[model samples]
Target: MTNLLSTSNQEEFGLNVLIIDDNEQITKMISSFLDMSNYECTVVNDGKEGLDLIKTNQYDSIILDLAMPEFDGYEILDALQRENPSYLSKIIVLTASNVPIENIQKFKELGISSCLQKPVDIDQLLSKIIDSSV
Candidate 1:
């Protein structure tokens, strides 16, 4: 893990974040913003690829989208829950779907740090990443 010191003497650190979204444009946009913020961002366009990366690597934070053709976000979450429950705390769900409140609550119960509906405010995502990394 890389340690990126904050601008202040308090010494906050930036994290390595993984972004799993099928939308290439969205991934590119988020990756650009995160790169500017000093967080190491790795993006994948397929859910299966994202899950494979998660299994093989360690990430301080994850920005996940709920919808995908194969191996959707839910599957990724389930795998993480079964294999690495602790990692769930680092997740930030970013979905464009109009999911029910109950499902949102379910995700929260599974230990996701936050669930954001797209088009997510980049500033808010940055803030959440900073907070979670600490």
Candidate 2:
């Protein structure tokens, strides 16, 4: 997993990914996998903190969980819609709850790159991340 790439090629392939989830284990697993895949990862457990980071830093992709405490994903999305709509294209929403079809459509309307359920396949997630970045 420590096979580092050349500095130039790394810049071409590596993406700065921010993963925001209340579940520590999920974040750790995703971050580790992305790190091994040559993507830099930042993990945030609190939605409020995650929102702050989203506002202050630029990341190539954001993996966001819809259910979280102290300012949930909807709040973050709403805030971004108001002030940072461009970032929506780089966001992949993940939720365990059974979201309504209308809400799912809303997500697409908001320009989210993808919406995935919990227990997502790592490979598919990686594919979405790559595709969205492209």
Candidate 3:
């Protein structure tokens, strides 16, 4: 478990969080952490299902993975950019791939809150979640 002692935020609870990742372990770990921290979490390991959920429900924060087999994160992002641009503020990109600076800049320009590399510290991820939801 992450050392929650390092987080400075006030007590928080019941934030609706959606985690969309292809990796089961990653999603499980995050969902477990969020649940332990009193967040309402929904996890989808399939990119298509994740996109569907995004279209149908609003979330406090969205943790998105860049790589998936069928319907990748970029496609979801593009769809959101066209249909619901405001949701961009709630998006936090989590990827292991080495994204070029220009693409990272593009994600920033598109209003993505954070583009964190994989193996991210759970505290840092929580911080990004807190900051972006605000």
Candidate 4:
């Protein structure tokens, strides 16, 4: 198991992040990047598990994928909206899907901070996280 946070900078800025995606590669890649950047990260491979963690833990941000088996990102979003609206402010949707403009607008209405397409630009994502953390 990977260390969730870097002790090197936890005292200064312990940003905890949760990454929810069915793609193992994507989760690992993001986690590695965030860990190196001094952010604590927990990766979940399914939406259900992700939802559970969100309910029970505290995180500064969430990186979510819209497509997954067992429970898709929409369902997770809906659950958060209904059961824990505050979480909406911390989510950043990261999906490879060519989502419709209407759907993207709806996601914004649901209070997601941002919707980013896959093959994510690491610098942009890091910037978004930093901006949101403030």
Candidate 5:
């Protein structure tokens, strides 16, 4: 079967992606890789900023980290889902936390599109984005 997650099809797609992560290196890396694609990326180092950005803009996807000060990814997700369910479908959690089965269930309940564990696998991240767009 053909792998539908290939980036070859992404040329026709134009997306605005928000990446929320506390790790500077990871954020830069993810943004760099994503920028090389057809997507526009805006990265924030904390949940509060991420939340604020989400409030002000419409993003095709959100790559959120589970751990952060003040507000966590879950909190942001909850707030976004409460305020706008349409955006909820675009969220993808990028976390290093050992997300439990129950938590995963909760993520699903909150309408998270996908959850990626860190240290981020670039190929997997790209694949997820491609799959999501498709």
Candidate 6:
């Protein structure tokens, strides 16, 4: 298990994190890591299903992928922002896309929490979560 869980008051916070990615392997890896901690995580393989889950439940955070089948993360973001403004602050973009600088800037302007590239660093992700929770 990751060390961050032992140091943080994760149980008190009751973090609910949603991961939206089409890649099953990536999703499993992320879920396993999160489950080892105090995070209550839900993974969805399709963007449409991810968006539906988001609308149906409340989450402390969301890790979104740029590309997926049925619907893309961008569309899901737009829809969520329109329906639930508060969720805007909780969304984090986690994708393998080589996005442009301008696009990254736009995401920041839209109030996304953070953007994590592909081959995500476990340490970095844990740090972000711990920091955000605080």
**Over the stretch 1-134, how does candidate 5's per-residue lDDT look in tens digits?**
33333657776766788889888998998787677765789999988989999899877778889888788887887787788777766877878899999988877886668887887667687666656544
How many clashes (backbone atoms < 3 Å, residues ≥3 apart in a chain or on different chains) does model 2 have? 0
TM-score of each: 0.87, 0.89, 0.91, 0.89, 0.85, 0.87
lDDT of 4 by residue, 3-37 (tens): 32434645576689999999999899888878776
Can you give the lDDT of residue 85 in candidate 3? Answer: 92
How badly does each model clash, as a count of residue pairs? 0, 0, 0, 0, 0, 0
Candidate 6's TM-score reads: 0.87
Which of the predicted structures, 3 or 5, would earn the higher lDDT when compared with the native? 3
For model 2, residues 39-125, the per-residue Cα lDDT tens digits are 989999999999899899989899999989878999999999999999999899988978889989999998999999988877678
Ranking by TM-score: 3, 2, 4, 6, 1, 5
Candidate 1 structure quality by residue, lDDT tens digits, 1-134: 22223345222345799999999999998888667656688999899899889888989889899889888998999988999888888889899998789988888888789888887766687767766565
- lDDT, candidate 6, residue 121? 79
> For candidate 3, lDDT tens digit of each residue in 1-134?
55653444434446899999999999999999788777889999988899889889989999999988999999999999999999999999999888899989999899999999988988799889988888
Deviation (Å) of 108 in candidate 6: 1.1
The TM-score of predicted model 3 comes to 0.91
lDDT of each: 0.82, 0.87, 0.89, 0.86, 0.79, 0.81
Candidate 2 clashing pairs, residues 3+ apart or interchain:
none
The TM-score that candidate 4 achieves is 0.89
On lDDT, the leading prediction is 3
Better of 4 and 5 by lDDT: 4
